[model samples]
Target: MTTRTQTLSQAGAQSGILPIIGAAVLGAFLLYAAGFAEASVLHDTAHDARHSIAFPCH
Candidate 1:
Protein backbone atom coordinates (compact mmCIF):
# COMPACT_ATOMS: atom_id res chain seq x y z
CA MET A 1 0.00 0.00 0.00
CA THR A 2 2.94 2.35 -0.48
CA THR A 3 3.36 5.00 -3.17
CA ARG A 4 6.46 5.11 -5.38
CA THR A 5 7.97 8.03 -3.47
CA GLN A 6 7.53 6.34 -0.10
CA THR A 7 9.05 3.11 -1.37
CA LEU A 8 12.09 4.91 -2.73
CA SER A 9 12.49 6.85 0.54
CA GLN A 10 12.41 3.65 2.59
CA ALA A 11 15.03 2.06 0.36
CA GLY A 12 17.27 5.10 0.59
CA ALA A 13 16.98 5.23 4.36
CA GLN A 14 17.90 1.57 4.74
CA SER A 15 20.92 1.91 2.46
CA GLY A 16 22.14 4.98 4.36
CA ILE A 17 22.66 3.04 7.59
CA LEU A 18 25.37 0.80 6.08
CA PRO A 19 28.01 3.50 5.39
CA ILE A 20 27.65 4.71 8.99
CA ILE A 21 28.08 1.16 10.27
CA GLY A 22 31.13 0.61 8.05
CA ALA A 23 32.76 3.85 9.22
CA ALA A 24 32.26 2.90 12.86
CA VAL A 25 33.85 -0.49 12.28
CA LEU A 26 36.82 1.03 10.43
CA GLY A 27 37.43 3.53 13.24
CA ALA A 28 37.30 0.78 15.86
CA PHE A 29 39.85 -1.30 13.93
CA LEU A 30 42.21 1.67 13.57
CA LEU A 31 41.99 2.48 17.28
CA TYR A 32 42.62 -1.15 18.18
CA ALA A 33 45.67 -1.26 15.92
CA ALA A 34 46.94 1.94 17.52
CA GLY A 35 47.29 -0.10 20.75
CA PHE A 36 44.32 1.31 22.58
CA ALA A 37 44.35 -1.97 24.52
CA GLU A 38 48.01 -2.91 23.96
CA ALA A 39 51.47 -1.43 23.37
CA SER A 40 51.42 1.21 20.61
CA VAL A 41 54.92 0.60 19.31
CA LEU A 42 54.32 2.35 16.00
CA HIS A 43 52.99 5.44 17.74
CA ASP A 44 55.98 5.51 20.08
CA THR A 45 58.42 5.24 17.19
CA ALA A 46 56.83 8.18 15.40
CA HIS A 47 57.80 10.45 18.31
CA ASP A 48 61.57 9.93 17.79
CA ALA A 49 63.93 12.56 16.32
CA ARG A 50 63.83 10.78 12.98
CA HIS A 51 60.11 11.62 12.83
CA SER A 52 59.95 15.33 13.45
CA ILE A 53 56.66 17.22 13.02
CA ALA A 54 58.25 20.23 11.24
CA PHE A 55 59.65 19.84 7.75
CA PRO A 56 63.45 19.58 7.16
CA CYS A 57 64.99 17.61 10.03
CA HIS A 58 68.09 19.77 9.58
Candidate 2:
Protein backbone atom coordinates (compact mmCIF):
# COMPACT_ATOMS: atom_id res chain seq x y z
CA MET A 1 0.00 0.00 0.00
CA THR A 2 1.26 3.47 -0.92
CA THR A 3 1.62 6.01 1.88
CA ARG A 4 0.02 9.43 1.57
CA THR A 5 3.33 11.20 1.08
CA GLN A 6 4.29 8.82 -1.69
CA THR A 7 1.01 9.43 -3.47
CA LEU A 8 1.33 13.16 -3.12
CA SER A 9 4.88 13.08 -4.45
CA GLN A 10 3.79 11.09 -7.46
CA ALA A 11 1.00 13.53 -8.19
CA GLY A 12 3.35 16.48 -7.90
CA ALA A 13 5.79 14.93 -10.35
CA GLN A 14 3.06 14.26 -12.87
CA SER A 15 1.67 17.79 -12.55
CA GLY A 16 5.08 19.28 -13.21
CA ILE A 17 5.63 17.01 -16.23
CA LEU A 18 2.33 17.95 -17.84
CA PRO A 19 3.24 21.60 -18.39
CA ILE A 20 6.68 20.74 -19.78
CA ILE A 21 5.09 18.31 -22.22
CA GLY A 22 2.52 20.91 -23.22
CA ALA A 23 5.16 23.54 -23.88
CA ALA A 24 7.23 21.10 -25.90
CA VAL A 25 4.25 20.28 -28.09
CA LEU A 26 3.46 23.94 -28.58
CA GLY A 27 7.05 24.75 -29.51
CA ALA A 28 7.16 21.89 -32.00
CA PHE A 29 4.02 23.08 -33.72
CA LEU A 30 5.32 26.63 -33.97
CA LEU A 31 8.59 25.41 -35.50
CA TYR A 32 6.75 23.24 -38.01
CA ALA A 33 4.49 26.10 -39.03
CA ALA A 34 7.37 28.54 -39.35
CA GLY A 35 9.35 26.19 -41.56
CA PHE A 36 6.65 24.51 -43.66
CA ALA A 37 3.78 26.95 -43.89
CA GLU A 38 3.54 29.09 -47.01
CA ALA A 39 5.68 32.20 -46.90
CA SER A 40 2.81 34.49 -47.81
CA VAL A 41 1.13 33.49 -44.58
CA LEU A 42 3.97 33.29 -42.04
CA HIS A 43 6.17 35.97 -43.58
CA ASP A 44 3.80 38.89 -43.42
CA THR A 45 2.67 38.01 -39.94
CA ALA A 46 6.19 37.54 -38.58
CA HIS A 47 7.53 40.58 -40.41
CA ASP A 48 5.01 42.96 -38.99
CA ALA A 49 5.53 41.53 -35.52
CA ARG A 50 9.28 42.10 -35.73
CA HIS A 51 8.89 45.68 -36.93
CA SER A 52 6.39 46.40 -34.19
CA ILE A 53 9.15 45.68 -31.69
CA ALA A 54 11.75 47.62 -33.75
CA PHE A 55 13.48 44.42 -34.83
CA PRO A 56 15.45 44.68 -38.05
CA CYS A 57 13.91 42.11 -40.34
CA HIS A 58 16.21 43.30 -43.13
Candidate 3:
Protein backbone atom coordinates (compact mmCIF):
# COMPACT_ATOMS: atom_id res chain seq x y z
CA MET A 1 0.00 0.00 0.00
CA THR A 2 2.78 2.41 0.89
CA THR A 3 4.61 1.61 -2.32
CA ARG A 4 1.50 2.24 -4.37
CA THR A 5 1.01 5.62 -2.71
CA GLN A 6 4.63 6.55 -3.35
CA THR A 7 4.33 5.54 -6.97
CA LEU A 8 1.25 7.66 -7.49
CA SER A 9 2.87 10.66 -5.83
CA GLN A 10 5.95 10.24 -7.96
CA ALA A 11 3.90 10.01 -11.13
CA GLY A 12 1.98 13.15 -10.21
CA ALA A 13 5.19 15.07 -9.62
CA GLN A 14 6.63 13.83 -12.91
CA SER A 15 3.52 14.67 -14.92
CA GLY A 16 3.63 18.27 -13.73
CA ILE A 17 7.38 18.53 -14.00
CA LEU A 18 7.71 17.16 -17.51
CA PRO A 19 5.48 19.78 -19.10
CA ILE A 20 7.32 22.64 -17.37
CA ILE A 21 10.65 21.22 -18.43
CA GLY A 22 9.48 20.59 -21.99
CA ALA A 23 8.15 24.11 -22.28
CA ALA A 24 11.49 25.47 -21.07
CA VAL A 25 13.37 23.47 -23.66
CA LEU A 26 11.02 24.59 -26.42
CA GLY A 27 11.31 28.23 -25.33
CA ALA A 28 15.07 28.05 -25.28
CA PHE A 29 15.16 26.59 -28.75
CA LEU A 30 12.86 29.32 -30.08
CA LEU A 31 14.91 32.08 -28.46
CA TYR A 32 18.11 30.82 -29.94
CA ALA A 33 16.50 30.40 -33.36
CA ALA A 34 15.24 33.97 -33.14
CA GLY A 35 18.84 35.14 -32.72
CA PHE A 36 18.93 36.29 -29.11
CA ALA A 37 22.63 35.47 -29.01
CA GLU A 38 23.38 38.17 -31.60
CA ALA A 39 20.89 40.69 -30.19
CA SER A 40 22.45 43.97 -29.09
CA VAL A 41 19.41 44.96 -27.08
CA LEU A 42 16.31 43.12 -26.04
CA HIS A 43 13.03 44.97 -26.29
CA ASP A 44 9.39 44.06 -26.32
CA THR A 45 8.79 42.47 -29.70
CA ALA A 46 5.21 41.73 -28.89
CA HIS A 47 2.71 43.96 -27.16
CA ASP A 48 1.43 42.98 -23.71
CA ALA A 49 3.84 40.08 -23.39
CA ARG A 50 3.66 38.32 -20.05
CA HIS A 51 7.41 37.80 -20.26
CA SER A 52 10.30 38.58 -22.55
CA ILE A 53 11.32 35.88 -25.00
CA ALA A 54 15.09 36.47 -25.01
CA PHE A 55 15.56 36.42 -21.25
CA PRO A 56 14.37 33.74 -18.88
CA CYS A 57 11.47 34.84 -16.72
CA HIS A 58 8.28 33.71 -15.05
Candidate 4:
Protein backbone atom coordinates (compact mmCIF):
# COMPACT_ATOMS: atom_id res chain seq x y z
CA MET A 1 0.00 0.00 0.00
CA THR A 2 2.86 2.40 0.58
CA THR A 3 4.74 4.26 -2.13
CA ARG A 4 8.55 4.50 -2.06
CA THR A 5 8.62 8.17 -1.16
CA GLN A 6 6.14 7.71 1.68
CA THR A 7 8.13 4.83 3.13
CA LEU A 8 11.38 6.79 3.06
CA SER A 9 9.70 9.82 4.59
CA GLN A 10 8.40 7.80 7.51
CA ALA A 11 11.82 6.27 8.10
CA GLY A 12 13.54 9.66 8.02
CA ALA A 13 11.15 11.10 10.59
CA GLN A 14 11.68 8.13 12.95
CA SER A 15 15.46 8.33 12.81
CA GLY A 16 15.68 11.88 14.21
CA ILE A 17 14.04 11.01 17.55
CA LEU A 18 16.76 8.55 18.65
CA PRO A 19 19.67 11.05 18.80
CA ILE A 20 17.64 13.46 20.94
CA ILE A 21 16.88 10.70 23.45
CA GLY A 22 20.52 9.57 23.49
CA ALA A 23 21.82 13.08 24.12
CA ALA A 24 19.37 13.53 27.00
CA VAL A 25 20.48 10.28 28.64
CA LEU A 26 24.15 11.13 28.21
CA GLY A 27 23.67 14.61 29.65
CA ALA A 28 21.87 13.21 32.69
CA PHE A 29 24.65 10.71 33.41
CA LEU A 30 27.37 13.37 33.14
CA LEU A 31 25.46 15.62 35.52
CA TYR A 32 25.07 12.84 38.07
CA ALA A 33 28.75 11.87 37.87
CA ALA A 34 29.96 15.43 38.22
CA GLY A 35 27.73 16.14 41.21
CA PHE A 36 28.11 12.90 43.19
CA ALA A 37 31.44 11.35 42.19
CA GLU A 38 34.56 11.50 44.37
CA ALA A 39 36.47 14.71 43.92
CA SER A 40 39.86 13.16 43.23
CA VAL A 41 38.67 10.83 40.48
CA LEU A 42 36.79 13.57 38.71
CA HIS A 43 39.69 15.94 38.97
CA ASP A 44 42.15 13.36 37.69
CA THR A 45 40.03 12.50 34.72
CA ALA A 46 39.51 16.14 33.86
CA HIS A 47 43.20 16.88 34.21
CA ASP A 48 44.16 14.03 31.95
CA ALA A 49 41.64 15.04 29.35
CA ARG A 50 42.86 18.61 29.35
CA HIS A 51 46.44 17.56 28.85
CA SER A 52 45.49 15.07 26.16
CA ILE A 53 43.82 17.87 24.26
CA ALA A 54 46.96 20.01 24.62
CA PHE A 55 45.19 22.36 26.95
CA PRO A 56 47.49 24.07 29.43
CA CYS A 57 46.20 23.17 32.88
CA HIS A 58 48.84 25.14 34.80
lDDT of each: 0.59, 0.70, 0.58, 0.69
Please provide, for model 3 over 1-58, each residue's C-alpha lDDT reduced to its tens digit, 9 standing for 90 to 100: 9999999989887675778889999999876645444343332343224243334422
Per-residue alpha-carbon lDDT of candidate 1 for residues 3-56, written as tens digits (9 for 90 to 100): 988999888787877788899999998655543433446456433432344322
lDDT of 4: 0.69
Candidate no. 2 TM-score: 0.39
lDDT of 2 by residue, 1-58 (tens): 5798899988887676778889999998885555445567675767666557654455
TM-score of each: 0.38, 0.39, 0.36, 0.38
Q: Using lDDT as the measure, name the better of candidate 3 and candidate 4.
A: 4
RMSD of each: 8.0, 5.8, 7.8, 5.7
Q: Best to worst by lDDT, what's the order?
A: 2, 4, 1, 3
Error of 1 at 33 (Å): 0.2
Candidate 4 Cα errors over 4 Å, as ranges: 1-14, 38-40, 43-58
| CA error at residue 40 for candidate 4, angstroms | 5.4
* Model 3 ranges off by over 4 Å: 1-14, 36-58
What lDDT does candidate 2 reach at residue 22? Answer: 95
Error of 3 at 41 (Å): 21
